[model samples]
Target: MRRIITTIDIGTTAISTIVAERQKDGGIRILGVAQGPTFGMRRGSVVDIDEVTVSLKKTIQEASKASGMNIKKAVVGVGGTHINTYNTKGVVAISRADGEIAEEDVRRVIQAAENSIPKNPNREIIHIIPREYKIDNESGIKDPVGMTGIRLEVDAMIVDGSKSALRSIIKCVEGAGVEIDDFIFSSLASAEAVLSRRQKELGVMLLDIGGGTSNYSVWEEGRLVQAGVFPVGGTHITHDIAVGLQVHIDTAEKIKLEYGHAIPELFSKKDVIKLADFGLNGDDVYLKRHIAEIVEARFKDIFELASKELKRIDRFGLLPAGVVLIGGASHIPGIEEIAKKELRLPIEVGKKVNLPQPTDKNLQELLFTYPVALGLVAWQVNQLSGDNRYFYNPTFESVSSKIKNWFKVFIP
Candidate 1:
């Protein structure tokens, strides 16, 4: 029996792994968590399989040892610039003679929704999540099972990616001695970790800022309205800092973590950083405000891009619950203030909490880094037990087998 859930997020900047157990209660107990730098991936897609395999093996071994659990199979989180999403609707005549909708009817409508999208040889369906459903004159039904309806209709968000890219990720994970159990969109997994039902219902945006690209999702009325990835991320910021300061990438990353701020005015002109302080040269110094300016410009562009994406979906700055920032880039100081100024909405950092008793010190500190992993754990727990209460929306079926069922729907 599989009682524990293991998750690995293949990110652009880092590979995050976590081993957690679902308690008798609804909460999760973090047994072990670990992260490793991405040696072979860029923008969340595999580039060098060998390097990624070695790095993933090390991270998995570390987490397994910490938890004293033998890790065999793992749920994988996927995100990249290759990811693309669009919305389409499908309708089907209810098959039951009594006109009472059943689970099979719901499934058929979802499959119809997917079939409406033409197949692309170069791309594959990564996720086909049902967003809304309609029955004849009735609309907005979430779960239509047991409901009376004549014509069943569904609107779904289709997420697809480069087929070659996905195959490479599967190969790398398997090469590391762990079998891939399932695949979930990394941003959606992060939503499971940080978003509450009320937040989704009241309208909220989730921004998962990673290393090479940032993944964002908009939720309103308890359904996903939009999902997109920005090509710029923390790595771009570090690159800008390195170029502006004429320093090494490592040095720029260190400075960004130490003194990075989205609001340059928050720092005084007199507050200076000496090169020697960070194991660099002697006596040379740079004004903190100047460094802040470099960091601020890059993030401003990210938020501005986010504003445009929101406007495309007509949810621009209108989410009542506002935007929740997660992932590695969210650690930057004063980032929320910059987001607020650029987007004209309330900005907040996603909460890292609600873990079971005996919380590991590492989990408490690095929970921010493992949002997607935590979400994978939550998702698996719900899948095994059919616990739809975890998330208000009912889209878990598509997390793994939804695509397979798409073709099965055509069979007589």
Candidate 2:
């Protein structure tokens, strides 16, 4: 039987599973998908182990049933404030073997770089992405293999996360009876879904506004430049609306989705919405301006947070392709306009590609919310088939081994 790859995205508000089969043409055929309301997670961190396990099993079982395949292993996405990155450097004496560099040389240099990472008890390195490689006196070489050099140097960005957080996610998957092939950063996964080759080459920022958190990844010259996660997200907006309008959380959420606009003027004053629950006098009371104000205030705050993050990275005006917004909160009306105004760059809503055409256009419109889930599936397929197109290097075995060692040091 042909093997299939599954990906489970246990996000802040939802757990989604996707199954895909490798195709002959090096592409993926999505076999099935399932999503359910997430439990035991808040702001992208696993909190309740049992709740997360139940949700994971339910979503996985649904997807497995649809695909008619038993998924035993998967690539999962991890994101939270605990995720962090730092720069590290490594140098190695190039062996004089016909004056040519080999893959092993590059791998050794990476391992040397990995040595620079501090063995923190609470954190483990998740990924080591080379920013640039230098061979002898030559600088800015992306690939060192097959090059002629006496000394090799490398600068890499090391991504690390809290050991407890990672262990929680791993335990949840194991409890669900699924093996974790790999754990990908949530922002990185979202970047894979919406960022184009040109965008990465030219420099771009991917901002995924999820239910309980907003994650960001910066790409420049076709490499991951930086990544981060903020605790604020769509849930904050709902909370603001609920408090401002004196309505229940569910009602506030519905109001935000149905009539929310980042810009108040985007919704006309004459266009009124009835709020039966929030009304002070009557059930049919209408308040168009009030709702717009509440949404606009929350959106402005979210955009301002994004702006601060961009400015802190000094990439506010540097990204050639600007910002690509994905995830559930990106569905808010006028969000693109808000991003453009706040970030002072081009903004567009990101959508998931490589999916079958849906009969319902409305459902198609909602696909952008599933970018992380879809990207997880894409990452899983790449891992299963040894596709290194997404990463700078392609070998999973070497990478996994390095991470395993790092995990041991971190957890111990």
Candidate 3:
């Protein structure tokens, strides 16, 4: 029997679902992918349950039809302004008479580190990434299994999200008749699909700019160190375009795609683009430089916010691999140039090279936009049988459920 796996990403602008089959050779093949306009979601969080549920049902149903699979369970992607991350450390003593550290000892140390964080009723831990381990004061141990040490220590990064926001996501998915196998942060998932081993080890930052929110993840020394979400994204840019050009949002989005560039100086004032089709004057001509100016402003703001997060962790100039950009907004022209200028760092756009290309060429390009969905499948496969290279702690144990069924809402 073919092992069927599905991943669902409910974003502010769209609901994307990817259904894949695990091949006999331990590879994944794309079976179906559905990308539909999202409704009732704002800044990556569900706002209207009924509307979001309807969109989710439609997206999953389309994928189900294409793949001919029921897709009862899925690994979901969640991110928004409510997401947060911080560094934490956990320590524990080996519970064996021989002082040998076993797998359980490693889990205990990670659990201890997770427990170090203050409990917040409103927040729920989403990811616990072990940075490094120390055994018997010998520091910098990456793996502690099968080692002899009386004392074990682990430094990890804890990713958390709003409890209310998480519950809302769960409700939407369950309403769609899909069980949630696990929930991964959108930026982390994107990093899995785009970031390289060298980038993670040498230090790199990833930004996944969706329609309503921009999510970021920083990896250094082969570990995720920081992650966050900004309330601003492509949708905000479209709104700005609409307000500035006196056009409808749909038209502004089209113009932004067709004419917008992040670095205004690269374009000429004399070079004008006609927007007569968008209800502009009969001789409607807009200075390309002016459109670029608006694009540059918001993009600068995004980089500035990202800079603040890097500054907080003292990683502004510390990352040698620099910044990697992904998501829908990253497609905007001249964004890399503007990011390089504004952030004063090397910049490159992230691509979905890690995944196997779909048989349909058009669907292969969809991987770039729907990377989180792909990463969700990758993470699940890895968790089930593949070596646990990424963060694999199943659920946060310290924070008690604020609402009944909150933690178990998606479980079958």
TM-score for each candidate, following the candidate numbering:
0.92, 0.89, 0.92
Arranged by TM-score, best first: 3, 1, 2
Candidate 1: regions farther than 4 A off = 354-366, 388-412
**Pairs in steric clash, model 1:** none
Give the per-residue lDDT of model 3 (tens digit) for 97-215.
99988988888888898778888867778878888899987987778889897899998888888888888887888899987777788888887667777899999999888899998
Residue-level lDDT of model 2, residues 1-412, one tens digit each, is: 5667787888888888878776655565667888999999988899999999999999999999988989898888888878887888999988767869887788888888888766776676777788889987889887788889789999888777887788888889989999887778888777665677788889888888888888988888877778888888888888988888777798888888887777777556677867654443456544666777787777777778878878887888788799888877787777888779888988887764533222223323435656876677656655556654335332334333445565677666
For each candidate, C-alpha RMSD in Å? 4.0, 3.7, 3.1
- Report lDDT (CA) for all predictions: 0.81, 0.77, 0.82
Give the range of the ten consecutive residues with the poorest summed lDDT in model 3: 394-403
Q: Candidate 2: which pairs clash? A: none
Q: Is candidate 1 or candidate 3 better by lDDT?
A: 3
User: What C-alpha lDDT does candidate 3 achieve relative to the native structure?
Assistant: 0.82
lDDT value, residue 134 of candidate 3: 92
